[model samples]
Target chain A: MKKYTYTDKKDTRSGFGAGILELGRTNPNVVALTADLAGSLKLEGFIKEFPDRFIQCGISEANMIGVSAGLTIGGKIPFATTFANFATGRVYDQIRQSVAYSGKNVKICASHAGLTLGEDGATHQILEDLGMMKMLPNMTVITPCDYNQTKAATIAIADYQGPVYLRFGRPVIPIFTPADQKFEIGKALMLNEGPDVSIFATGHLVWEAIQAGEKLAEEGIEAEIINIHTIKPLDEEAILTSVRKTRCAVSAEEHQLNGGLGDSIAQTLARNYPAPLEMIGVHDSFGESGTPAQLMQKYGLTADKIVEAAKRAMERRV
Target chain B: METQQLEQIAVQVRRDILRMVHAVNSGHPGGSLGCTDLFVALYFDVLRLKRDDQGKVIFDMDGRDEDLFFLSNGHISPVWYSVLARAGYFPVSELSTFRKIDSRLQGHPATAEHLPGIRIASGSLGQGLSAACGAALAKRLNGDDKHVYVLMGDGEQQEGQVWEAASFAPHHKLGNLTAIIDLNHQQIDGPTDLVMNNRDLGEKYRAFGWNVTDMKGNDLADVLRTLHESKNDSEVPTLILMHTEMGYGVDFMMGSHKWHGVAPNDEQLATALNQLPITISDLKDY
Candidate 1:
């Protein structure tokens, strides 16, 4: 087992802000819009450098989505930022008709996703965003694990010519992935290779899965850790290849058990290869006011939950 | 174009509106008839559209040379399609394809089927204004400076997103954008006042920070003059409150909400066509 160390923790949105700044330097067509959450979404850097290109669309999320779609007409790549709840549920129809159905080159960058958006309660957190966004025909859903990966994904989506939902989180997590790692839109990253069991995780849950893999190694369990960032594309080849080797799997994410990353992997496995699988996510319930760490433990999204789910899935493998 | 010629086109547009609705047996005629003259004025006089002298030649130009129009209240597709056809965007014969399966002209105007003249899909009300605003912004970005026009039903003012867009354009100072409200006072259920009272729309737009203007939509001269005036104001996005009878031109259907979404019967269609001073052959060449 390889022990990963972190110098300092940072929220994934800062990585997005940095990536957008880099994009501004490289591509002049990349513009940004925020719905009164510019500071929260970490878009101040981009706003400062490219003030003319940055649109502050007040507190109206619906108008923001529409304006983002409109910005794509003259071949401008628009990145619209807001909270996950308002980004998806609040402006679904706007995104549907304007961005998604219209096939506009708009990146719907959402921060503070799922239960990890703690203390804001269920009203602010959204667990069904992945399902809602991925269900759209031309939508590309990406949920980066940490700061480095989020920055890489943001820069990457600027060149991708279609509607993309880039989901990130509020909490400062481990920055384990290499700083120079290139992000492929639909490709999953294999963290540690093993055959005992495959653990697929996304967003803020990736660090937890890595920790679980280290703990499982102490118990003589070789867990293969795979980062499934792009949930819509679902890296089916990588998932099936790993599941074939391990013969069992455990899926983890900060979203709900019904329509999160786990549900997507489960459906894929059910059709292609039958494998024993356990899901580590929030059950059928809304989140409450709590710290990020407390909510992770209370909602069964910690490293221990992943380790337990791995053992349970291995037991069912036969 | 002369006022008399524009009036002749308006009569022909009204005739097209009646025939298309009667053919489908399921379309909105009242607002379509009401907005006929305004659409005609926009396509014929106000807009810098590339057309031949005969008004039938498809002016070959790159996508960049195109001037765009979006019908936010797309229930009035008959008027828009008629005007587009009359303005040489496509063949006038395509007017027969309204609401028919395998037709580019859907019940609502959409770009999903790659309708050449339509830049965005706009069947769903209140969404088109934002889209038009987007297109207007795109024009600014492209440095094209081409105008973007959108039409919304007076009843469609109930949508919150419309106000959202209304508030947005002026803040951005989108001078290239123009939005017209078909102030026929009628919607799907009944009169807009009865269903959802849009109290003083001109004052409402003024409150939302738009340069407001009013015109009698059925009157060709007023439609042309108001639209021309709207183009001159470069600091604010223009909104025209086009006052018109729900069912204009047709005697039986005029001044009532009953003909809003209902198609005229066979006898009613004949009477409506007879009321027009122009013949169908004169419009068929358009």
Candidate 2:
């Protein structure tokens, strides 16, 4: 929990691809469908190894979601793979009617989520997918932190008997979470426990939270960093337990502040136990074409921002 | 079992559709009446669904190893719900609870209500065909030769997702799926041509690489023949464009798009019931 380090850095999408290949070997019922982004989503290994199990859905994301919903009827677990924009907002009605409302066990594995999908501009970079998917009934929204956690979460959701939105990114972030860690759906991973402030981070921001935690530790602020992988079935208890001890909280994510991880934590705190909170994310602006690192800094989704927000939240602590 | 018997059941299903809509005053009767014969022909005779040891249809969400049907143009819940009950998917008496609060018979066909025959929710148009394509692909993967069927309205063709699915089925060679479009030429707005004309839908499907078939939707014998022809064309997915009048059975409502989503008043309901002669008596009337 002190200082975290990574031996390698890889894109989380590759972990999704690796996870698909693993499912191809183990679960006969698992099938992968992609909207012509197999290469971007890193699904070549699964496609080559289990060609029969892979479906190339062309550029039709709506049909892919509907098809994924249908595959569940005949006892096949379908992972409908696409970019975050095409996966959630584009085919939201298809997901709502067929997957979520119908209670079909389809895993909507989305790659290139958030501002971290560098240089594609705002059209390809989807910041509202988490909120869109989470608002639907029977939808499990997940944003795993690293490659290992993304891979683990990919395999873990197939066992769940409902629809899931597993959001990952194209950027090569650090692989800090253990490769052999058993992925729990709603359980938050306590990366670092402290009493000063609670830093709840998800997706790409989890690594940034650790960076901020170290910097805060040098300033004599022991920040509690908890990785909130599952955003919809949020580990409310973990949030409460951490925030109750710290008396203040800061939520970080590579998304909008309005409906991202921060809003989930805000609502939980407001209902169960009121606490001073600061949110670190994009403040209602579309991301432009830029490097992932540049975009993170520009959108206020970096470690310095988290540290700044943490200090602000600590200042407002009663 | 016989065409005559199927017609007898169709008459009662029509009565149920009219009465169900009349009771609720908030259901689609035009499309429901239009697709009555097709629904009866499929559920009562054509579909090869899984039966128990004693021949009772086993109703499960994951209907593996059996034929599956998904209704995409689900505004016609009256027709589907009545047919399912008449097919013994649920008690016919429960049909009385159609559109009532907390009843399983929702305004649209939804799996959330745990309805026996419905595999997925559909009311928002243009999604069912893709689901059928997926189910057909699943059948191919599982090595189960059982079929997947889906029904869509003609006006529902305006949805771009339908074309996405239309292109997919033949491209993937989903021969195990049969997609039927009720060519009622009517949506909630008005005539489909007046709304947005989809010129030659069968030609469009054929261009999309489907084995296109034309069926007289209201005609029971033609519906059965189309089903047989479609069931045999298992190398490429078949699209049966079922040309039907908007309101087929009732003399006054026949061929009118005005009844597309409007429930009949008391007088109109009585008039519609008078035109339909019930012959299937073994099933309880809702």
Which candidate leads in TM-score?
2
Q: DockQ: which candidate is best?
A: 2
In the range A1-318, model 1's lDDT, one tens digit per residue, is: 667788879999899989999998899988888889999988888888999888888988888888787667667788999998999999888888777876778899999998888998989989889989988988999999999999999999998888999999889888999999999999999999998999999999899999999999999999999999999888999999999999999999888888788899999999999999999888888888999888888888999989999999999996
Candidate 2 residue lDDT tens string, B1-286: 7999999999999999888888878899998999999999999898888788988777987777888888999999999999999888998988889999999999998989898998989999999998998888988888898888899998999999999999899898888889999998877778889999998998899999999889999889999988877877667999999999988899888888889889899999888888887776523453
On residues A122-236, what C-alpha lDDT tens digit does candidate 2 reach at each position? Answer: 9999999999998998989999999999999998998888899999999988999999999999999999989999999999999999999999999999999999999989999
Model 2 TM-score relative to the real fold: 0.98
Residue A3 accuracy (lDDT) in model 2: 73
Q: Give the i-RMS of model 2 in Å.
A: 0.7
Clashing pairs in 2: none
Name the best candidate (by lDDT). Answer: 2
What stretches of model 2 exceed 4 Å from their correct place? Answer: B282-286
Worst 10 residues of 1 chain B by lDDT: B57-66
lDDT of 1 at A313: 94
Model 2's CAPRI class is high
- Local accuracy by lDDT, each model: 0.86, 0.91
